[model samples]
Target: MTGGPKASRRVICAALAGAAALSATLFPGAAALAGPADKLRDSLSRGRSAEISAPPIARFVAQDGRVFVLDRTQPAPMLKFEDSPEVWVLSPSPAPRGDVIYKNDLGEPMLRATRLGGVTLFSRQRPAGEPVSLAGGGVPLRLGGLSPQALSERMLQASVRSGRAARRQVVFEAEATPASAALIADAAMVVSLAFVRLAGRDRDALGQVDSVRFSEGRRPSASLADGVLTIVVSPGHGLAGRPSSDRVAKAIRTAD
Candidate 1:
């Protein structure tokens, strides 16, 4: 007589799958982007969480057929595109109609989810948003472990790229260790993203960044002082140990 949350989730998934199929037919070539969607759907049919209150970690298929995964199990929720190695930390905010909107560090909308389990993704590829349907629960996103040597190399490469873009020395001073390797490596990218965000706001802002310093601390944070950007990472905080790239950028902006 009554199906409960799991049954409701299945029905929603079915409806979305139907929509996706119809879209493919109406808009020729839409099927090209359905590979990931098909895979996700198959996984969902296997099993996943059915409650909207605590949405499951899952892959979602956009109306345009683009695929991405959203993992909420992390200390800070993370998003990863199917074609990218980068994992984005997103901040959740309330939206209309009992939906939730996830935004990046720059306060830009990345994804919006309805209470019923539908998602809308916003990106440069699709500024407005593309309707996204539940695919199925997905694996958690984990930062790859790097040896001390590899960590040093990654920091070097990241600093070089940041420096080249800034037209000045973007030296990085990091304390390396096996436990902190992944966080440190990701810190380099966070600083780089911060620089990019700064440059986006003001083309010459990158000129103000001289160096970046990383250290372990009680909490994650970023600060800019006298042209130096310092990032504090708390190893105990796990994935949330380092200040987000958006926070790094904000620190620079506020300092300027």
Candidate 2:
């Protein structure tokens, strides 16, 4: 009878020991999972918004080693570069007012803008002999001998077309990239974009961007380093503008 009670006591002690060992084994894993979850929640609570600053005059370098400076503060912002390609005006913002000028790797001038009545226009002045054709869903406007202001009006009268042939849309989509998408996001802006080759070389020497996110409808600005290409765009109020299409076109034209 004594042996029976002693055996029961030994069994109860063994069961208790097993339970404690199992708990000890699980504690580290449970703590590990909780740690990451707690960190993520804290990060979400402290998330910050993007900041906007005054527009800065930007400089663009061409494949031919030409440098162009654009001062957005000027009444008619112009490009200052020697032997530079023709200046093209791309997007102008502020609704029915604003202008951006740019040149392509080929050094051609392509202009896009909007008028007071919310009309959009795209203009490209090819080399003296290059072909110029105006065809779209809307009536073609005669572009000859028209001042920039008048030309913008006539172009607006013409129907806006879709596809690769549309100069503004083409340039708009071309300068887009993953980094630019992040910038647009930071600015709380959205866009529709397609991926195009980097401005200079096929093999990008620029390091991989880890913190950037690319999406459809957003475009990146042009950048080059050690033969690699990197473009970044972020979101912010100061980045707001009208005729984003034109801005995109100008960026493409100016990219090396």
Candidate 3:
């Protein structure tokens, strides 16, 4: 089920707003780190390493073009897909249980960590068409400067191949928000989709998201189009579970 033009606009607008808010929160102490664009470039220059001791906050560009901000403090890294990496991963002080794997474009594994205390990973890769697939039922999602039509088509193909009903929807758009735009512009590919099932809805609300995980504070809200699904990630603002879900739903409904 594709969204109408109005719905698309709404989604875009809401996304822009949410993206802006997210950016502010993620880099609270980065005022000295320059703007996101500058910081992004700085982060990219320092390539990822295989060193795994304490989960260090690092950044990398996935083959698909998504900027991943990994926080080693949680049980696992929090992931969000946009033009840039602004999503935050949170866990208890003891750190949670999860793993981080570094791989190249060919699906070859590089570094894998079994425990992450509290670290972050950022990426310098621009939008590019590359395939990245995770362990399990994850399909590699392509990321780059794709036209809406082109992105839609690729999503359709992926859905057909995966045998899952693809849902596409236009959430929103915003030009006034540079931060939001930056997040979207920085993504080069879709790495993995982490599906989280909402209670009471036998269906996983985030079943179609392309990233391995959405940021800790964000909840899953999405719309399905012709074989394409667009999931919206928003700041938690101290909310969780169904409230977060509803916030995402409302944002999508009011996007653009």
Residue lDDT tens for model 1, 230-253: 888877666667777667767877
Q: Which stretches of candidate 1 lie over 4 Å from their true place?
A: 1-55, 105-108, 124-128, 135-138, 196-201
Sort every candidate by TM-score, greatest first.
1, 3, 2
Q: Give one digit per residue, the lDDT tens place, for model 3 in 110-133.
A: 334443222233232322223332
- CA lDDT, candidate 2, residue 133: 22
Which model is ahead, 1 or 2, in terms of lDDT? 1
The TM-score values for the models, in the order shown, are 0.68, 0.21, 0.23
Q: Which candidate do you rate higher for TM-score, 1 or 2?
A: 1
Candidate 2 yields a Cα-based lDDT of 0.32
> lDDT at 243 for candidate 2?
18
lDDT by candidate, in order shown: 0.77, 0.32, 0.35
- Taking every candidate in turn, the Cα RMSD to the unseen true structure, in Å, is 14.1, 22.9, 25.4
